[model samples]
Target: MLYLAGLAENSIVDGPGLRFTLFAQGCPHRCPGCQNPETWPFAGGQAAAPEQLVERIAQDPLVRGVTFSGGEPFAQAGEFARLGRLLRARGYEVACYTGYTFEQLFQNGNADQQALLHNLDVLVDGPFVQREQSLELAFRGSRNQRILDVPASLAAGRAVWVRARRWVLDEQPPEA
Candidate 1:
């Protein structure tokens, strides 16, 4: 079961195309100036089954992508991973927004977090830094965040900026 703060049945802001965005409940990194402060608590969200969400997502044929937003999706990694697996099997592009960097998740995350990482096609990673916030960024709130190609990062064992034109328009990843 997935505990969600809310869901956007059709959203373009979350990704490149129309997407079904799931906002998980409960956030460990309560970044200041968060857009969704209501989602910071874990206890009040509506419980949803991943299968049911899949069914709901299927109702909209135009939504070919799914984005896991949060409340920190990794907090419920095991469940979200299952949902991501299901979504991928159905031919949906799966993306995620995470406060944790790929390096942190790669080197220190738990089994479920690693599993969830594997299931994503794209990952927008890093805590939202108020000082780094920018209006020009694409699909991200801060300059420190990255739009990563999940498979390549997993293979390289480091964060690899996605070369997709839609996600990155000459937005370079931070220097190592």
Candidate 2:
């Protein structure tokens, strides 16, 4: 079961294309200026089975993908990994927002967190930095946070910034 703060459907601001965004239930980072403070309590929010969440996503045919926002998605990496893998199997794109940097996820994340990383197409990584806050960054709250191309970054063994796909709100994604 996964703890979640909320879910947003048909959300354009969450990621590329209309997405189902899951705000996780608990967090330890407690980053200053967090957009969702209510998500901080580890015990808050109802628990949801991974399959049930995927089933909810499956009902929306127009949704291009899903974004796992957080109380910290990595906090329950194994369950989210299961959800990520299931979403991929259903032919939907997967993206995740994390307080942990990609390097930290790779080096220090548990087995499930690292596994979940493999299932992601995109990763919005790093904690929100109040000082690095930017109104200009696409899909990020702060300059220190990055929109990373997960598969390519994993393949290259380093974080790879996605230059071409960087988009402001309402831009259409490139066709495959």
- Candidate 2 per-residue C-alpha lDDT over 39-103 given as tens digits, one digit per residue, 9 for 90 to 100: 99998698899999999998989997899998899999999999999999989989999999999
Per-model TM values vs. the true structure: 0.96, 0.91
How would you encode candidate 1's per-residue C-alpha lDDT over 2-35 as one tens digit per residue?
9999999989888898999999999999999999
Error of 1 at 3 (Å): 0.3
Top TM-score model? 1
Alpha carbon deviation, residue 71, candidate 1 (Å):
0.8
Error of 1 at 94 (Å): 0.4
RMSD of 1: 1.3
Q: Which run of 10 residues does model 1 get worst, by summed lDDT?
A: 167-176
Clashing pairs in 2: none
* Cα-lDDT of candidate 2: 0.86
Model 1 off-target regions past 4 Å?
170-176
